[model samples]
Target: MVLVSYILAPTLAFCNSYGTGLTDWNLSSTYGKIGLFIIASLVGSDGGVMAGLAACGVMMSIVSTAADLMQDFKIGYLTLSSAKSMFVSQLMGTAMGCVIAPLTFWLFWTAFEVGSPDSPYKAPYAVIYREMAILGIEGFLELPKHCLALYCGFFVGALLVNLLRDVTPKKISQFIPIPMVMAVPFYIGAYFTIDMFVGTVILFIWERINRKDAEDYAGAIASGLICGDGIWTIPSAILLIFRINPPICMYFGPSASS
Candidate 1:
């Protein structure tokens, strides 16, 4: 399977990146994951589930990497920046993320066994992936009873979306609730969703108050905030690694007395 994937990976990456660059849409990463899942399932016949999972991981990594590079190039084109510089920066960022991500995870896992009953971080995405893999390999019976309602809701939501687009005025349609926004809350827990809500509210308020310069500076401000958030993680991880307690840390769990 590795040999076959190696032979075909370049073509796969090219197709994924080409579509992403042309459309500026993010379907490539998703479609690549699906393609890898299918290929892995086929490979499972000979090498079992682990082989298939490994293949999917490899393909997903390749496809996502290619897609990221293409998207960065697209951004560079729009911004009149050098594609070579963007590529170099992306490579550096990716390398650092590969190293730091695991270490950060280890820090968190040591601090709190995430997804455990006592842990605040429930890892909803990991649970979804595990469920998806189980359903894919073990058939629909492995799915929960609520999945039936979910399937029905999906079709109902699709129909409603079409109805909304048809009946609502174009200007009003733009303000209508997006299905993705509505659906995401079901996938993620409240803590993350609260952040999303807060960010959306902040953006809305910013647009209302700074209508004149919003278009010019809003993106830069948001970008700065995002970069700051990410940059702060380095110091956070260092503090965790060195066992340096902060001045204040929120203890969301049981009290020490309890």
Candidate 2:
């Protein structure tokens, strides 16, 4: 699996990087699924799951790193920074992340019910990826009724959407929803969709009020929001490590009578 990944990683990573540059969306998980299925099918049932997972990890890392490096390169270009410095920094960051990410995950895993249905951090892709591996090993016989058909239908639809977007006039193409962006809600849920919509609305209103300022500060504002949200997790993790729970727990659901 590792050997196969090494042979294929460069091509797959280049494709992923190009797609990321165009869309700002890394489809590493999509590439990982390809690796998962291929490795699982080859290895057969006995050790298939483990082999498949390892292949998936390798493919995902290579693809995501390439895409991220390209993104950073773009940033460096825009900011007139040194390419050599950026490359070194990217390598250092990736090396540190390899160590830090697992430890951070361990902290969260020990601190909270990470993958549980009721957990705030459900790690939905983990479930999806595991299921993909199982499907690869077990074959399509285990799939629910109409599942394969649905998958095929959507596959065709996505291709058609892209084809239309490519051939259509720019004005029409601009309004056409990206299949990749639309697919995100299927796995991650609509909460993020709502967040994006709210953010867009805010930005639109800000632009209406002050177009120049919005154009100037929009990226910085968005980055700050994203960084702030990510940084909050450090404190949250510390609080959880200390067994300090929030005083107020809120839950919302349909009425019992309903």
Candidate 3:
């Protein structure tokens, strides 16, 4: 989404700003390639106090997300969701990304460089995930334990909600709603707020304000989501450390090329 907007916004604004003419897809891909590094950093790391400094890529990645969001809102046609929700979404995405992000790094390192000890594929995240995957207790595999802890919290919270509703019963559940019983709430939900829902509010606002012409609004909202919610996904990649600069460039050895 950010890819599409970062591409189109400049081009459309450029056409309006200048006299250039080009198809939207062409423009988007071009910018996406150019900004891939920044995108990488933001996804890979979300700016921890000390640890993030070592991850230059990840720190840059977080800055890029926040910077782009503020700037994009100027041209953004949809601005319904409050800034607070956007912030929460960013953190939520980061936590979820902490799980999904490493998978990509691992896939590349494990599959392509299998049995190559000195391969450039070994980076920070690759090492961590390789360790974890070997341990077999990380990412989605940890979901059961995560869910159990979450359900414990929810059960406690819901018990309180239930007891109160029994007494007053005037939609006390409305205030602290009983979660989907069969569905079973997960710990991630406690933190995440399940807010792919915010986009609906933004879209509805765009419909009313922009006369239902949602093209730019779509771009704006998407840019917000990517830079906003999708910031730390790449750090998961960087955490793996894929030697973007080949070992040959860094002068390791001849087999490094192989």
lDDT (Cα, tens digit) per residue for candidate 1, span 88-171: 999898899899988998999899879976679987755664444444454345557888689789969867985897799998
Tens-digit lDDT track of model 3 for 43-160: 4433221222223233334444444344433333255556666666667866786788789768886678644567664456545433432332222334456775775797687677
RMSD of each: 10.3, 7.8, 21.4
Flag regions of model 3 displaced more than 4 Å: 1-55, 68-77, 114-258
Clashes in model 2: which pairs? none
Ten-residue stretch with the least lDDT total in model 1: 22-31
State the local distance difference test value for candidate 3: 0.44
The TM-score of candidate 1 is 0.49
In candidate 2, what are the lDDT values of residues 128-225, reduced to their tens digit?
88878888888666778998899999999999998999999999999998787787667556654665676679899999999999987776676555
Residue 236 in model 1: lDDT: 76
Best by lDDT: 2
Can you tell me which runs of candidate 1 are displaced by over 4 Å? Answer: 1-51, 70-79, 82-135, 155-168, 227-258
